[model samples]
Target: MDLDNIKDIWSQENPDTTPEISLENQKELHLPLEKLRKNMRKEFWSTIVLFVFIILFLTFVDFHFFKFKIYVITLVASMMLITAFYYYKFFLLYKNLTSVDFNLLENLKDLKFQFKLNEQYYLGYYIAFVPFTVAEVILIFEFIPGWKNLTGFSFILYLSIFCLLMLGALYVVGKWWFQKFYGKYFSQILNLIDDLK
Candidate 1:
């Protein structure tokens, strides 16, 4: 940006000053923030694509890709897919979540607090799913012919219980996270948006 253009923007603070601000200077000021927003959107979509592909494969293709049986392949594929997606998505969400240029410091500080709280909740999600994931993978071994007698009903029971446990964990985590982070700041952001309107 040209010095005179920078001077123009800086001069806005002081009515007594007369300075020219370059268009380049204005563009430069906004460039980083725009880049950050675009990068965040890109990261989000990457994870979304990963998840959609996993769902597509599981829903359509049979999983016998190698020496692994279909059941084992499905179990491993699903678990790995979910784990990677969650890890990647949460990492990006925490890393990219940000705000700035608000009119009030209190509002900005609240938004900062929300970012921290959300990171914590993502960590919670990572922890809660571990047990469920283990159980989900075990169902594959039970599909072996003779193994059905030993693992059949028990396997189904484990799957059912694990699913319920996962949901309960998610609910608890969500509630706690909402109260800890999102509940307070969400309303504030909404109010700010409304006021701007």
Candidate 2:
């Protein structure tokens, strides 16, 4: 065979057309995505349930002081806003994640976007709770007769310490929650993308 003729024939084949994936192979490829979708949905519904419970508690439970009621209302309102915004975000993520017809590169790009978005969301979500946590401490001081004496620098110190501790705990818990739910699948998808590359 002439070398130039063989090279010309090989180069004529369509390079853009990907091989058709077998059903079993496609299912295997999508397994991580399916698991991620399930976990995200579970998180979304659980958040809804928790929000409903909080609303019920705030509406039904009696707080003798008007200030306490106002605090609870504020807390609920903030929580509602945060939850709504994040739910929308989660919905978009779910929609994108479950979408089909994407090739390997597109899938990898989407996954990387999701991983980064989630990291930002996790940070914002935890930071958003800081105000409520501080409010709880304020309410405790306001209501509890014995603790009312905490004031001036002492109160400031106590509040600062408590807030810092709560933030630290929230950070740790958020990391663990994400790691447990999405991190494993993220790693798998990353590996798949790498292997494809």
Candidate 3:
């Protein structure tokens, strides 16, 4: 193949016919994949750690150390599940982020698709917390074996106070964090779409 001659002809093409997903842009994107993949690997391992810790902790609670202790464990279990769920959501997002490569037309589409998936992931995260937050309150006061002292009224009062405090703090932190991280990325994707147009 006459590579030099092919480039000479290709470079002279009418600009209007070519889409904004240009070859140069795609080439630049390839450099980031390794970094993205590294992040994905880190996320994967962190999730495994969360899983193991939760299981081990629940096992400890099964030994029935104290009546009130189980409530504490139930709280811990709820927190762990919530933590693990959010991380898993991030893993899904990062997995898509890592797979993007702008080296081809299909890859550009893939990048956009990946970002859309990330958006859904965030919405899903919010939806999941709803049930988790509710169940955590319910489990603390209703379920969880070995209940003693603490009147049902007192139980509700203390549990509501503690969970509301934790949930509020977590919500604030999550809002700030989501805006700091995912919000920026999603905007970047929108800009990319504009560039593509």
lDDT of 1 by residue, 1-197 (tens): 99999999987788654343345543443444354445445756776787688667666776444434455455656666655666575555445444344444344455456556655755665565665555554554445455446556876786667567766776687678555543454454445434433
Give the distance in Å from residue 196's predicted Cα in candidate 3 to where it truly belongs: 3.0
Each prediction's whole-model lDDT (CA): 0.55, 0.79, 0.63
* Regions of candidate 1 where Cα sits further than 4 Å from its true position: 1-39, 63-100, 144-197
Candidate 3 Cα misplacement greater than 4 A, ranges: 1-20, 27-36, 61-101, 104-106, 141-159, 176-183
Q: Estimated TM-score per prediction?
A: 0.39, 0.82, 0.57
Which should have the higher TM-score, number 1 or number 2? 2
Number of backbone-clashing residue pairs for each candidate, in the order shown: 2, 0, 1
Candidate with the greatest lDDT versus the true structure:
2
Q: Could you tell which candidate, 2 or 3, scores higher by TM-score? A: 2
* lDDT (tens digit, per residue) of candidate 3 on 1-197: 59998888888985545354677655545445444556456756876787788778677655544655666576667766766776676767676666655544556666667767766766666656665676666665554454335576887787778678767876787677656645554565556555665
Worst 10 residues of 2 by lDDT: 18-27
Ranking by TM-score: 2, 3, 1
lDDT computed for candidate 1: 0.55
lDDT of 2 by residue, 105-165 (tens): 6556666777778768867887888888878877877787877888899888887887788
